[model samples]
Target: MASPITPSTGLGSGLAIGDIVTALVNSDKLAKQTQITTQTKLVTTKLSGIGTLKSALSAFQTLIKPPVGTTSKLQFAGYSATSSDTTKLTVTSDNTAVPGTYSVKINNIATSSSVGTAAFSGGSTSAIPSGALTISQNGNSKSYTIPTGATLASVVKQINADTSTTNISANIITDDKGSRLVLGSTITGAGSEITTTSDITGFTIGKTDKLDATSATSAGYIGSVPASASVTINGLAVTSTSNTLAKTLGGVSLTLLPGSDNSTTTVTVATNTDGLKSSLQSFIDSYNAVVGAVSTVTKATVSDTADATTGSTVTPAALTGDSMPRSILSAIRNELVSTGAGGDLSVLSQLGITTGQSDGKLTLDSTKFQAAMDKGLAGNVQQLFSGTGDGSNGLLARMNAAITPYTQTGGIFDTRTTSLNKQQSDLQDQQAALDLRVTTLTATLTAKYNAMDLIVGQLKASATSITSFFDSLNASKS
Candidate 1:
């Protein structure tokens, strides 16, 4: 009729049942947990390595083949323009400019046409009779309606509101006498002049006259006619509607300064070897950066002492022995050494870019590069690098093509990353399942041990009761 005694510490059974159950559960889960942890770490490290490699490749690609609306540092042909007298005229040249010397004589700079209204006695607030005002410029005319009780300032604002259509703008110029309404044309050419006709009373407009005796106190046009830039290049006369003579010479832009009139200057265009050399050096550096990344990820280190836990003497990188990085490196190296269809300077070695024998990095031979430039092979070098605008011929183009597969969307790197992510997820699931199994096992073992302890306690209790009864009976018999 006695109840069984069950204690977690197992006092009745003389054993630590709780500790035994814990030890058994741990023993069952340790191996599986260890495996899962190791695999997850490896997957995470590999993914990080892949990301680093991809980033390096993308940077290199941007330098060589930049995105749309961006220009690559590598120019097909570079040129510099020098002016004999910068004060007289300044010149700039682009890749399209031909290397040559030109004798430029600037006659006059272009001037904009301007006209002003007679001084108003009422200043900016002077009222004018409401009427229609028409402004004409470059054969285009636009009419503006002057509102009732319009002031000079208000009329100027109204005129300016239609500036885009009329090619004219109005402003209020105030001198010691009074305020005057000034109108100027946005364009400057022989026939592009601002002319206005208005029926508003007290509105008298005339061209500005710089030569008039009282012109200093009156508002008028500065010159008699709209002027254009007059210049002669190499004994040929050239007229431009703007001071900036962009179409006067191929690849050359000349700006006629104020003091440049009646003065002659020489513009010299030459090859820009310095710019080309700098770009070439940048290409070498970027290429080497990619190579360095690959080397780092694929390196294996032999330690002097073995790791205490793993007990391994050789430590390999996450991507060590991985064929992806090695294959990428090999593909790019092939492009660097391969011959191109470009003439004369078809190979990188011709431009002093050579691969290192031991480290696989590019080295620029300054002496060889200068010699090639001195030999007048700069154009050929450019051709080798930039090609003829076609996408298939140059070294940069070929290198871009070679690495596109690995760096593009859903490419090799992406595929590898996806696989690694799935592997990580699967490992996590395995860990979860193992943890669940261990939990279940622990509960089952604990229940069984508790049941056994209860049985032992009951047996001991009955034995003690029987022994006590026997001792009592023996005493009675004695």
Candidate 2:
């Protein structure tokens, strides 16, 4: 902070005036500068610590409360469906599926109906007479105007464009004889069939016609009849328009695969023990992660021996004395240890989750969890974790409620961080004010020192003149 105009050394007084001014300015601002620095460091460190804690809490919240359009992890903890022969069929079940075994026999998988026109001699470039062509399927009919000079490929494109309305698609298949226009329905059922009729010449459209061009009595078109999936579950016959039968069983969906015709398989719905255990373990791990985060932020380290050079042996974390972490842990612990009102598994301990004594983390007893599942307590466990659709009953719900005040917007952590940020901003202002004061003090001290140096120089000049006068008088007397 040395000013360019300030003299490095006084010309008359022979003293370092610039150094003296700078020293005085530094001394005046030292205490306030140190205070601001300390405060700014504290606020920054605390903000970082709070951010870490908030991240941990948010991760835990995401695990408990998933986003919309997603199935909850707890739903998969109850029942699972397995097929004896997956090649023939596969099955999936929800929580509402009953635990039972069923014998399923597949008569045939459903197939869509397809009809092909007789081969034309002009291949894919075959021309057709301009007329209105109507295609009907499942009682839905769509008409297309076949313009003049329309080739087989062009007509196929027009027909396919209206497939959404007709539930039918058209394609051109070329063979050695020529190209044929094939139309197929997008649906599969007993009454779903593709029937094409047009006033165009040489376009014979019928259900029983053959697609071959070499036959003496070749019909204008050939078609394959649509069929539905036929299956028997536990000796009861069931029919579905598609291969996937969802409503056949309550909460159970059966999918028929290829080679399933005349095949039989068994499906067993049972408790998903491994899945439930893994989910519980995940919950335990997430809870422990929060505990670990809190510990990291609040832990204190004390040296075994205090050395004179080191000043102090005790070091505290940013949040060592903060009450927020303690309060958060207390809230979570209260919910974990509380008992539900009405459920077979009222507490988490019943599901093999217990809190640790030394470190407030959760531990899972795998043996006990497996035993609980083996005893058919999966439903009770699910209810315990998820509650009965109420906001306050379930473990997850209660835990969410407990932490909401701290994790929500304008919550405890946010408030603390905002306050700390404001403190940081205030510290910056204080530092700026201190710097300005120092600058002003330096200027004042420099001007006063320069004036004093000038006066001293004048006094020395006067003394030298007086001595010269005395010396001249003494010379005259000699």
Best by TM-score: 1
State the lDDT of candidate 2 residue by residue for 1-478, as single tens digits.
8453434588778778887888888888878888888788788889988998999999898888877888666554488889999999999887677789999999999988877766666877888779988887777778889898999989999988877767788888776656778787768877776777878654556655545556422434444577899999999999999999998987689999978899999999888887888888788888899999899889988898775855778877879999999999999999887885456778888778878889988899988888888777886766777777664688888888888898899999888988998899898888888888888888899999989999988998999999999999999999
| Candidate models: Cα lDDT each | 0.82, 0.82
**Alpha-carbon TM-score of each model against the true structure:** 0.74, 0.73
Q: Tally clashes: model 2.
A: 0
Question: Could you give candidate 1's per-residue lDDT for residues 154-248 as a string of tens digits?
Answer: 98898888887777888887665567787887577676666667786435344333323233345456456688989999999999888898888
Question: How far in Å is the alpha carbon of 187 misplaced in model 2?
Answer: 6.1
Residue 104 shift from truth in candidate 2, angstroms:
3.8
